[model samples]
Target: MTVAVTGIGVACGLGHGKTAFRKGLYEAPDIFSCLTREGRGPAEGEPPFIGVEMPEPSEVLAPRLARTASFSGRVALSVLQEAWQDGGLDDIDPERIGLVVGGSNLMSREQALAARDYSARLAYVPPRHAHMFLDTDICGLCASTFKIRGFAYSLGAASASGAVALIQAREAIRSGRVDVCIALGALQDLSAYDLHAMRSLGAMGSMRFSEQPGQACRPMDAARDGFIYGEACAALVLCRQDLAAAGKTYGRIAGVGLAVDGARGPEPNSAGQVRAAMTALVEAGLSASDIDYVNGHATGTPAGDDAECETYRTLGLEEARINATKSILGHGLSAAGAIETAAVFIQMKEGLLHPTRNLEKPLDSRFNWVRSEPAVHDIRRALKLSFGFGGMDAALVLEAPDSGGHTS
Candidate 1:
């Protein structure tokens, strides 16, 4: 059972498109300024909420369709279309394609408008609000628009949603289900709703990085504050190596594992993380030492970063060079894992890994953390880790396409 990642589409604080995102990886993070908060914006003089810029849907989609779609709808459509073309999916069987979108588009302005307006006469809810009212809307829209009449659904498990979606797609393809599956993820579109909501919940960063925006997301750094919510939408086209033999493959999704940390709140659990990692190793028919590097789940929060460091030490992978990409790209919530996987593809292709900046003091000296600058390295095998709220942990192992085990 072999799977290949034939195409990638990403839009994050780092950049958009595979080429730009790959180039941005060689430089500092670009958490410039958050411009997605329509109407309700940051107060004057406050440290601006940095965000990734996405092309306006109005320029590509018709005005009527663009206006009525939810923010996730716009992002999912844009990225999926890019991935579809990138993977040469249009030339393949339409019925063989499956659609899976992952996101927790909660507290969005569009949804707020739909559920509000308690007037004296009656509740005036626009018909267009129906789309925002349901998560199925995004999945359904992708299916209808693309004429991809296969299985379609949406789900969220905090930040690991994207990886979970990919894992599910891998299983389906391996189980003799769909021939090709397009898994896409989007989270907290350029809006202040999630920022304020995370602030109220005491989960977002409070450190004033106004003077140095690039250093704001200090993952695995001593001065780490919290994770910044960033807008992102990414899609990956997955198919069996046999089906995509002639196509370009970034890497192969060799193994996958998922677990629950069983934490009811904002707490860290190393057991779940280690379990997921071990399961992935077992599935890949590899061991701890088989991995050349790790793409850590470090999201800059003090507790999360500390817990991940402990997990790495427990798994005996402390010496394996680990890269924390949130230092370069702000957290994309559900889209984090997918976007980070894209980062891994670029790093693998280029034979180097980006360093974690802003680490004046290391959280754990034992862990071989890629610090402060790029490092020349040959990555034949890599593992990506993503842990989210409610103790959800997802892990994936990828091997170079030229690995002896894969024929693609």
Candidate 2:
């Protein structure tokens, strides 16, 4: 029972499509400005900066859909189509294909709007507003849009959502429930309300890096204050190794591990996170030395950076080269895993590593974090780590196509 990744797609605040997102990854923008506050509110100057203003539905999708829903729909449909072609699914059974998605704010802006307007007296705003509350049900929305009649679930572990979704999708394929599993990760549009709430939690920031909107996301740098909250949608097509054997594979989803630390609100347990990474390595039947690079879930938080550094030292991966994707694409929350995974696929394909922005100072003494420029390294095996609220930690190992191994 092995699983291999055959197709990948990503859309984020960096741009509308995978190519755009990839370009944004390697280039550091001078600034990352905050978008409209459509969902919850963040304080005036908080750490979780918002990205991607409400894009017109027509730009990313057809008419008659909300912006958030449209982004999800567009990415899912595009990935499904691309994967079908990439995997050569002409002879495959549509029924044998399943969909699994992870989302933090399903239709957060919509839900917030509906909740705000749909009081006892103002219950008749419009059907659109009413639909927002329903949009929070990510599972139903994803299934309906994709016409997937097989196994489907919407997992919400806050920031860990994407990696967890991939883990679950791999399990489903390994269990023989389906021949193909698609894991989609997306987030809702942000609003001032969301910004204010984040500010209330002291999570927002006044990180006015520069006039350039792209340069603001600085990961692992000494001046890194907080994260720029961005919205994105990404999808991955996972199939059995036997299927991959019949054709070509972008990479292999080698192993997965998850753990819980019970840390404070919206923060991860560093110890638990380390254990998860170790478990993933062990499950893959490999050692820490097998991993060449790490896509860190460093959200520019004080506790998170220190915790991750401690975990790296504990796992004896202090010398492992690490970079933070959040600094590039903003914190896409649930979509971060899928987006980062796509980036991993790119690196595996191109044989080049994107450097972590910032990182003038080491958060910890042991780990070798990347700086402003890309690093040239031999990346045969890569680790993707994600931490969410309630101390939820997830780790996934990806092997380049020639690695001769797969994940399940």
Q: Mark the 10 consecutive residues where model 2 has the least summed lDDT.
A: 53-62
Q: Candidate 1's residue-wise lDDT over 1-408, tens digit each?
A: 798999888776555577767777787656556555563466576555654455543223587777777766777777777788888887777888887777665436665444445444345666666565477788777887786766888878888988898998888788877889888876555345556666656667774775666667788888878886666778999988887847388889988999997897768788999999999988888988888899988888888888888888887886578888777777878888888887888898899998777877888888788888899988888999998888899999988888765332
Kindly report which residue stretches of model 1 are placed more than 4 angstroms away from their true locations once superposed.
34-36, 39-59, 113-124, 190-193, 406-408
- What does the lDDT read for residue 273 in candidate 2? 88
Assess the local accuracy of residue 391 in candidate 1 as a C-alpha lDDT between 0 and 100. Answer: 88
CA lDDT, every model vs. true structure: 0.77, 0.71
Give me the candidate number with maximum TM-score.
Answer: 1
TM-score of each: 0.92, 0.87
Clashes of each: 0, 35
Best candidate according to lDDT: 1
